[model samples]
Target: MAKEVSCPNCGKPVEWSEQSQWRPFCSERCRLIDLGEWLNESHRIADPTDAPSEDPPPSDDLSTPH
Candidate 1:
Protein backbone atom coordinates (compact mmCIF):
# COMPACT_ATOMS: atom_id res chain seq x y z
CA MET A 1 0.00 0.00 0.00
CA ALA A 2 1.20 3.50 -0.79
CA LYS A 3 1.81 5.75 2.15
CA GLU A 4 -0.42 8.80 2.37
CA VAL A 5 0.38 12.30 3.52
CA SER A 6 -1.49 15.54 3.85
CA CYS A 7 -0.73 18.40 1.50
CA PRO A 8 1.15 21.13 3.28
CA ASN A 9 -0.89 23.86 1.63
CA CYS A 10 -4.47 22.55 1.46
CA GLY A 11 -4.41 19.57 3.80
CA LYS A 12 -5.46 17.23 1.00
CA PRO A 13 -4.54 13.56 0.99
CA VAL A 14 -1.45 12.83 -1.04
CA GLU A 15 0.19 9.51 -1.81
CA TRP A 16 3.80 9.05 -0.92
CA SER A 17 5.03 6.95 -3.79
CA GLU A 18 6.84 7.09 -7.08
CA GLN A 19 3.59 7.91 -8.87
CA SER A 20 3.04 10.93 -6.68
CA GLN A 21 4.71 13.79 -8.50
CA TRP A 22 4.16 16.07 -5.52
CA ARG A 23 4.55 14.01 -2.39
CA PRO A 24 3.80 16.69 0.17
CA PHE A 25 1.53 18.82 -1.97
CA CYS A 26 -1.64 17.68 -3.75
CA SER A 27 -1.22 19.58 -7.06
CA GLU A 28 0.81 22.15 -8.92
CA ARG A 29 -1.45 24.88 -7.59
CA CYS A 30 -0.77 23.87 -3.99
CA ARG A 31 2.92 23.71 -4.69
CA LEU A 32 2.81 27.18 -6.22
CA ILE A 33 0.81 28.47 -3.32
CA ASP A 34 3.47 27.23 -0.94
CA LEU A 35 6.11 28.79 -3.13
CA GLY A 36 4.25 32.09 -3.08
CA GLU A 37 4.11 31.95 0.71
CA TRP A 38 7.86 31.53 0.83
CA LEU A 39 8.45 34.29 -1.72
CA ASN A 40 6.18 36.60 0.27
CA GLU A 41 8.09 35.86 3.49
CA SER A 42 4.99 34.30 5.05
CA HIS A 43 7.01 31.27 6.03
CA ARG A 44 10.26 31.70 7.86
CA ILE A 45 12.64 29.38 9.63
CA ALA A 46 13.20 30.15 13.28
CA ASP A 47 16.60 31.35 14.35
CA PRO A 48 18.71 28.77 16.14
CA THR A 49 19.85 31.19 18.80
CA ASP A 50 17.51 32.99 21.18
CA ALA A 51 19.67 36.08 21.71
CA PRO A 52 20.11 38.69 18.99
CA SER A 53 23.57 38.99 17.44
CA GLU A 54 25.64 42.01 18.44
CA ASP A 55 27.60 44.03 15.94
CA PRO A 56 31.37 43.81 16.09
CA PRO A 57 33.20 46.66 17.89
CA PRO A 58 34.61 49.44 15.69
CA SER A 59 38.17 48.69 14.59
CA ASP A 60 40.78 51.30 15.61
CA ASP A 61 43.38 50.01 13.14
CA LEU A 62 41.75 51.90 10.27
CA SER A 63 41.90 55.27 12.12
CA THR A 64 44.84 57.58 11.20
CA PRO A 65 46.74 59.03 14.15
CA HIS A 66 46.76 62.87 14.43
Candidate 2:
Protein backbone atom coordinates (compact mmCIF):
# COMPACT_ATOMS: atom_id res chain seq x y z
CA MET A 1 0.00 0.00 0.00
CA ALA A 2 1.15 3.53 -0.68
CA LYS A 3 1.35 6.27 1.89
CA GLU A 4 -0.33 9.65 1.90
CA VAL A 5 1.30 12.98 2.67
CA SER A 6 0.31 16.62 2.73
CA CYS A 7 1.39 18.86 -0.07
CA PRO A 8 4.50 20.71 1.00
CA ASN A 9 3.37 23.85 -0.78
CA CYS A 10 -0.36 24.18 -0.05
CA GLY A 11 -0.88 21.79 2.86
CA LYS A 12 -3.38 19.86 0.75
CA PRO A 13 -3.52 16.11 1.22
CA VAL A 14 -1.90 13.97 -1.44
CA GLU A 15 -1.44 10.28 -2.01
CA TRP A 16 2.10 9.14 -2.37
CA SER A 17 1.02 7.04 -5.32
CA GLU A 18 -1.94 7.63 -7.61
CA GLN A 19 -2.80 7.13 -11.30
CA SER A 20 -4.53 10.49 -11.74
CA GLN A 21 -1.33 11.92 -13.24
CA TRP A 22 -0.82 14.55 -10.54
CA ARG A 23 1.46 13.01 -7.97
CA PRO A 24 3.71 13.90 -5.07
CA PHE A 25 2.73 17.56 -5.50
CA CYS A 26 -0.85 17.15 -6.67
CA SER A 27 -0.04 18.77 -10.04
CA GLU A 28 2.79 19.75 -12.36
CA ARG A 29 2.64 23.34 -11.09
CA CYS A 30 3.05 22.21 -7.52
CA ARG A 31 5.91 19.98 -8.56
CA LEU A 32 7.63 22.95 -10.15
CA ILE A 33 7.07 25.06 -7.03
CA ASP A 34 8.64 22.32 -4.95
CA LEU A 35 11.60 22.25 -7.27
CA GLY A 36 11.95 26.01 -6.97
CA GLU A 37 11.91 25.71 -3.20
CA TRP A 38 14.66 23.13 -3.38
CA LEU A 39 16.70 25.33 -5.69
CA ASN A 40 16.29 28.28 -3.34
CA GLU A 41 17.30 26.25 -0.25
CA SER A 42 13.91 26.80 1.37
CA HIS A 43 13.91 23.09 2.11
CA ARG A 44 16.63 20.99 3.62
CA ILE A 45 16.85 17.61 5.33
CA ALA A 46 19.53 16.80 7.86
CA ASP A 47 21.44 13.54 7.51
CA PRO A 48 20.22 10.89 9.94
CA THR A 49 23.46 8.91 9.98
CA ASP A 50 25.68 9.29 13.01
CA ALA A 51 28.88 9.14 11.02
CA PRO A 52 30.06 12.34 9.36
CA SER A 53 29.58 12.73 5.64
CA GLU A 54 32.39 11.57 3.40
CA ASP A 55 35.20 14.04 3.09
CA PRO A 56 35.41 16.05 -0.14
CA PRO A 57 31.93 15.29 -1.39
CA PRO A 58 31.52 15.33 -5.14
CA SER A 59 30.58 18.72 -6.57
CA ASP A 60 27.43 19.03 -8.69
CA ASP A 61 29.04 21.82 -10.77
CA LEU A 62 25.76 23.66 -11.21
CA SER A 63 27.21 27.00 -10.24
CA THR A 64 28.30 29.50 -12.84
CA PRO A 65 31.65 31.25 -12.54
CA HIS A 66 31.48 34.97 -11.88
Candidate 3:
Protein backbone atom coordinates (compact mmCIF):
# COMPACT_ATOMS: atom_id res chain seq x y z
CA MET A 1 0.00 0.00 0.00
CA ALA A 2 1.18 3.48 -0.81
CA LYS A 3 1.43 6.14 1.86
CA GLU A 4 -1.10 8.95 1.85
CA VAL A 5 -0.86 12.56 2.92
CA SER A 6 -3.43 15.21 3.68
CA CYS A 7 -3.70 18.02 1.23
CA PRO A 8 -2.36 21.25 2.64
CA ASN A 9 -5.12 23.31 1.06
CA CYS A 10 -8.25 21.14 1.42
CA GLY A 11 -7.25 18.46 3.86
CA LYS A 12 -8.11 15.73 1.39
CA PRO A 13 -6.38 12.38 1.42
CA VAL A 14 -3.75 12.22 -1.32
CA GLU A 15 -1.70 9.25 -2.38
CA TRP A 16 1.99 9.90 -2.20
CA SER A 17 2.81 8.43 -5.60
CA GLU A 18 4.06 9.40 -9.01
CA GLN A 19 0.46 9.58 -10.27
CA SER A 20 -0.28 12.34 -7.79
CA GLN A 21 0.77 15.37 -9.79
CA TRP A 22 0.05 17.93 -7.08
CA ARG A 23 1.50 15.66 -4.37
CA PRO A 24 0.51 17.60 -1.24
CA PHE A 25 -2.52 19.24 -2.82
CA CYS A 26 -5.66 17.46 -4.09
CA SER A 27 -6.09 19.38 -7.33
CA GLU A 28 -5.05 22.38 -9.37
CA ARG A 29 -7.72 24.55 -7.68
CA CYS A 30 -6.28 23.75 -4.29
CA ARG A 31 -2.77 24.31 -5.57
CA LEU A 32 -3.70 27.66 -7.07
CA ILE A 33 -5.45 28.70 -3.87
CA ASP A 34 -2.34 27.98 -1.88
CA LEU A 35 -0.24 29.90 -4.39
CA GLY A 36 -2.58 32.90 -4.18
CA GLU A 37 -2.35 32.88 -0.39
CA TRP A 38 1.44 32.94 -0.55
CA LEU A 39 1.43 35.72 -3.17
CA ASN A 40 -0.91 37.83 -0.99
CA GLU A 41 1.34 37.44 2.07
CA SER A 42 -1.29 35.35 3.83
CA HIS A 43 1.50 32.95 4.71
CA ARG A 44 4.85 34.11 6.00
CA ILE A 45 7.94 32.50 7.51
CA ALA A 46 8.68 33.54 11.07
CA ASP A 47 11.83 35.56 11.55
CA PRO A 48 14.09 34.77 14.49
CA THR A 49 15.75 38.21 14.63
CA ASP A 50 14.21 41.19 16.39
CA ALA A 51 12.70 44.09 14.49
CA PRO A 52 15.16 46.16 12.44
CA SER A 53 17.27 48.56 14.49
CA GLU A 54 16.29 52.18 13.98
CA ASP A 55 19.86 53.46 14.26
CA PRO A 56 22.33 52.02 11.80
CA PRO A 57 26.00 51.46 12.77
CA PRO A 58 28.46 54.21 11.84
CA SER A 59 29.85 53.74 8.33
CA ASP A 60 33.65 53.51 7.81
CA ASP A 61 33.38 55.86 4.78
CA LEU A 62 32.02 58.67 7.03
CA SER A 63 35.25 58.61 9.12
CA THR A 64 37.52 58.76 6.04
CA PRO A 65 38.36 62.04 4.19
CA HIS A 66 36.06 62.35 1.15
Q: What is the C-alpha lDDT of each candidate?
A: 0.82, 0.69, 0.82
Question: What is candidate 1's local distance difference test score?
Answer: 0.82
lDDT of 1 by residue, 34-59 (tens): 98888766334554354578878666
What candidate 2 gets wrong by more than 4 Å, as runs, is 20-22, 42-66
Q: Would you list the clashing residue pairs of candidate 2? A: none
Better of 1 and 3 by TM-score: 3
Poorest 10 consecutive residues by lDDT, candidate 1: 42-51
Decide which is better by TM-score, 2 or 3. Answer: 3
Ranked candidates, highest TM-score first = 3, 1, 2
RMSD of 1: 6.5
Please give the TM-score that candidate 2 achieves against the real structure.
Answer: 0.44
Residues 1-66 of candidate 3 have per-residue lDDT tens digits of: 989999999899999898999988988899999989887663344443444657766677667666
lDDT of 3 at 66: 69
lDDT at 33, model 2: 87
Task: State the local distance difference test value for candidate 2.
Answer: 0.69
- Please give the RMSD to the true structure for each candidate, in Å: 6.5, 14.0, 7.1
